[model samples]
Target: MLNELFTLKGKRALITGSSRGIGRAIAMLYAEAGAHVIIHGSKPSAKLDEALAEARALGASAEAVSADIGDINAVKGLIQAVGDVDILVLNASMQHYQTVPDFDPETFALDVNANLRSCFLLLQGFLPGMQQRRFGRIISIGSVNQWRPGARLAIYASTKAAQFNLVLNCARAYAADGITANSISPGVIDTDRNAEALADPAIVEKLRSLVPARRFGSAMDCAGAALLLASPAGAYINGADIAIDGGMKL
Candidate 1:
C-alpha cells in the first residue's frame, strides 16, 4: 500500500509548457515514473518533436500538443483534443520585470493575462473532467515573489500572489473529489525565462547571496519535489503552496 501511494503506473498526465524548462522536466520525469506524458506548448517545432521522441524512448506514450491557454476557445480546444488525463501540471507562466519608475500599464496587463488568466481558463476546461473522475492531481507552478515582493516586478508579483490564492481556493473546493491541487513556488531558477536576470553578474551574485542555500536552482531541483507532490504519495496534500526555493522565503 505504501508503495502504491507513490506509484504512477498506468497513469496519464498532461503537462503544459512542456517544450522546455521546468515544464519539460516535469513531463519527462512523470514519464520515467510510469505515467504516459502528454506535452503541451505553443506550436509544433523540431524541439518539441525531439522531446516527444525522448519520452517514447523511455517507454511512455507521449504526444505533443499546441494551444494558447490565454484564449478560452483555444483552451477548450486543447482539452477536447487531449480527451482526459489523470494529472495536470500547469507549469507555463509569463513574466516581465521593469522598475516601477518606467513600467507601462499595458505590459503589466499583458503579464496578468498571460501569467494568471491562462490558468483560470485552462482549469475551467479541465476541472470538470477531473471532478467527474474523482481522482486527479493538479500542480501549478508559482513563484516566490508572490510571498516576497520587491523592486522591478510589482505587477508580476501581484499576479503571482493571486495565482497562489486561486490555487488554494480551487483546492479547498476540489479536494473532496479526490483532486489534490498544489503550487510549486520556484525561487530564482536558471531558465530562459530568467535569462536577463542572470545576465547581470552583480544581480546573480546578489540574488544567490540572499538564498540560504547559496546556489542557483534548476528545473531538476524543482522536479524532485514536483514528482512527489504529483503522485499518489501526495493524495492527502491539498491547498499547499510549497516553496521549492531553498529557504529563500524563509
Candidate 2:
C-alpha cells in the first residue's frame, strides 16, 4: 500500500527548468518513480541533454524541450510540444537581487513574466485536460521568501507570494475536479544558483545561523516533497504550501 501510494507509475509529467538544480532533482525522482517525464530548459544545453538521457536511462520515457518561459510565443510552443501532462511542475523562475529602490523596470517585468505569468499561461494551457481527466497535480516551486521576504528579493518575493495565491485559488476551484494545486517553498538550497554566495565562508555561516537546522538544504531535500505531492499519497492534500526550509521562515 505504501508503495502504491508513492508511486507515479503511468503518469506523464512536464517539469520546467529541469536541466539543473531543484527542478532536475524532481524530474529525476519522478522518472525513477515510473513517470514519463518531459524535461525543459530556457534553451538547449548539455545539462538539458544530460537530464534527458538520465531520465531515459531510468527506464522512463522522456523528452526535452527548450523555451524562454517569459515569452508568450515560446511558452505557446512549449505547450504545443508537451501536449498534455498529468503532472505540471512550474519550477522555472527568474530572480534579480536588487532593492526595491534600485530595481529596474525592465528587470521587474521580466521577473513577473517568468515567475508569475508563465505559471498562469501553463495552467491555462494544461488545466483543461487535468479537469477532464479529473486527476491532476500542479506543483509550483516557490521560495521561503514568499513568507519571509529577503532584503534584496523584493520583486522576486512578491511574485512568489502572488503565485502561491494563484495556487490557492486553483485548489479551491478545482478540488471537485480532482486537481490539486500546491506550492513548495525551499529555503537556502545548495544549488548552482547559490554557489557563488555559498563559497564565501562568512556568508554561508551567516545564512546557516538563521536556520534552526544550522545547515543549508540540498536540491534533493525539496524533491521528496515534490514526489509526495505528485503521487497518490498526497491526493487529499490541496491548497497547501509545504516549506522545505528547515525552519528558516521562523
What's model 2's overall lDDT?
Answer: 0.95
The residue pairs found clashing in candidate 2 are none
After superposing candidate 2, which stretches have Cα over 4 Å from the reference? Answer: none
Model 2, residue 203: distance off in Å is 1.5
How many Å off is the CA of 48 in candidate 1? 1.7
Estimate TM-scores for all models: 0.93, 0.99
**1-250, model 2: which lDDT tens digit per residue?**
9889989999999999999999999999999999999999999999999999999998888999999999999998999989989999999999998999999889999999999999999999999999999989999999999999988999999999999999999999999999999999999999998899899999998899999999889999999999999999999999899999899999
Q: Note the clash tally of each candidate.
A: 0, 0
Candidate 1 lDDT over residue span 133-176, tens digit each: 88888888888889887687887788888887888988998888
